[model samples]
Structure formats: C-alpha cells, structure tokens
Target: MRTLITIVAFLSFGLLSEIQAQEKHEILSPQEFCDKMKSDDVQIIDVRTPKEYKNGHIKNSTLINFFDDDFKEQLSKLPEDKKILVYCRSGNRSGKASEILENLGYKNIYDLKGGMLLWEKAKTDCY
Candidate 1:
C-alpha cells in the first residue's frame, strides 16, 4: 500500500512537470512574434531555402533551410541554452522546425504561427 501511494505520487509529479514544460515552447502570433523579434539575445532561424530566403525574410534571421537533408543535424548543433525563434514562408515548415528544436532538447522554442504571411499582414517592419 505504501509502495502504491509513492508510485502514484511520483507519476502525478512527473505529469505535472511535463505539462509545465509544454508551456515553455510556444507558437506565437504574428504581432507577438514580431514584437519578440525586436528583442535581443534570441537566435531567429528562417528555415526557408536560400532562393526563398533571398526573395525576403525577417532582417537578421539565420537561414537553415528546413528542406535540407541535414536540417535536423544542423539544428541540433545550436546552443540548447539560447532561446530560438523559427519561421518559414507559411508556418508549416517552421512548425516542423520547432519540433526538431524540441526533439533536440532546446529549452525555449517559439515559432511564428503564420510565418512570413501573417508577419506581412501585421505590417511588421522587415528587410
């Protein structure tokens, strides 16, 4: 009976921690994402290809090209201690990018919910 009680308590504590951990990774709206982008000390990764990125992208964003076969491996090299903000043309690829970040054990991950599409809609300044 004592063992059962301890096991249940441990399981509940673990679940609670997982729920809190999920909140650390966020999908930001265009406005919120843009606002956050203005801040310093974040690694903003644009997961679009070079051609797509050459067309337009958030100023100062680092290009990682999610379609690259090495996308997962390359992303894993990023410092896990730094916060990451990711985006792509329409948000789909960026969503996948954020998942990669999560799998890589990055602590803080933020993705633009609608990517550049919504960022332009919000009239956020960009290069």
Candidate 2:
C-alpha cells in the first residue's frame, strides 16, 4: 500500500509538470503575432517548404522547412531563452512544429493561429 501511494504521487507530479510545460506555448492571432514581432527578443521561424517560402514570407523570418529531416535538429539550435514565433502556409504545419518545440522544452513558443493564409486575409504585411 505504501508503494502504491508513492507511485500515484509520482505519476501526479509528472502529469502536473507536463501541463505546466504545455502552458508555456501559445497560439496568437496575426495582429498579436505582429505585435510580438516588434520585440527584439522574438525569433520568427517559417516552417514552409523552400519553394513555398520563395513565394513570400514574413520579413526577417528564418526559413526552417518543416518537411526536412533536420527540422527538429535545426529547431534544437535555437536559443531556448528567446521567444520563438513559428508559422507555415496554413495553420497545420506550424501547429505541429509548435508541439515539437514545446516537447523540446522551449518555454516561450508562439504559433500563428492561422498561418500565412489568415495573415494575408487579415491584410498583414508580408515580405
């Protein structure tokens, strides 16, 4: 009974930690994303393909293809202390990338709510 109690306590702690970690990640609208971009500590990441990126992307954003085999490896190189803003063509890829970032222990990750599609629809300027 003592061992069972200890196991339950340990499992509860683990679950609480996971929830706290997930809370650090957020989904932001285009306007909110733009506002955050003004901060010098924010690092913008475009997770689209090279060809898609060539069509257009946010100004001064870094290109990190989501489909590339080195996607996670590349993300691992980012400074964990800085705020990371990630987006893709639509919301799907960026959503997945944000999960990866969160799992990698990024404390301040922001994913664009609707990606470039909504960004453009909202008349947010792109490069």
Candidate 3:
C-alpha cells in the first residue's frame, strides 16, 4: 500500500507539472506587447482579415486571418520554438487565436490586450 501510494503521488505531480507547462498563455497591454516584440525569435501574427491587414498592421507581423478555413493549418506552419504574439482588429479574435495556438502546442503565446484599436490609441506605430 505504501509503494502504491508513492507511485500515485509521483504520477499526479508529473501530470500537474505538465498541465502547468501547457498553460503558458498571456495577455499583454499595448505597451507590454511592444516591449515583448523586441525580443529575438518572436513571431508577430495579425489575425485580422486581409482588408483589415492591408489598411494597417504592426510592422513585420504575418497575416493569418482567424476566420480562414485553414487557420489552424496556417498556424501550424509557424515555428513552434518561437514566441507568438497575436492580435486582431479588436481583442476578441486575437484572444481566440491565442487559445488555438496554445491548443496546437505552441508553447509561448501572447495576446494583445485590446488589439489594434487599443494599439492605435496607445500611439504605437503601425505599417
């Protein structure tokens, strides 16, 4: 009974750690997101539609429309090792994109708090 108890506790701890590791998603304000974008190996993704993207987007951000039928597949093409920063016109779509990225096994996920609207209000430069 003692040995069985020890094994169960060890297994439980391992499972807990794994779960914690997988829950590495974060939401960042415009300023915070800008700061994090400076880091190396970061992949900035704009989840807005092509029209929205063409209007304006963060410099160097890749377009991956959240509504696209192949959205998940497009996301899967990104390098899993890099940190992913996601945003949309408003915060809604980006939030959903961040969750999908997490579920798809991209470890480092960051969502812009208020998306492009807040970003523009914050006076952050866009391209």
lDDT of 3 at 59: 87
What candidate 2 gets wrong by more than 4 Å, as runs, is 1-21, 124-127
- What digit string (tens of lDDT, one per residue) describes model 2 on residues 1-127? 9999999999999999998765767899998899889898989999999999999899889999999999999999999878999999888999999889888888789999989998988855433
TM values, all candidates: 0.78, 0.80, 0.79
* Local lDDT at 32 for model 2: 89
Q: Comparing candidate 1 with candidate 2, which one achieves the higher TM-score?
A: 2
In model 3, which residue pairs have backbone atoms overlapping below 3 Å?
Answer: none
Most accurate candidate by TM-score: 2
Between 2 and 3, whose TM-score is larger? Answer: 2
Q: Tell me the whole-model lDDT of each prediction, alpha carbons only.
A: 0.85, 0.90, 0.89
Stretches of candidate 1 above 4 Å error? 1-24, 125-127
lDDT: which is higher, 1 or 2? 2
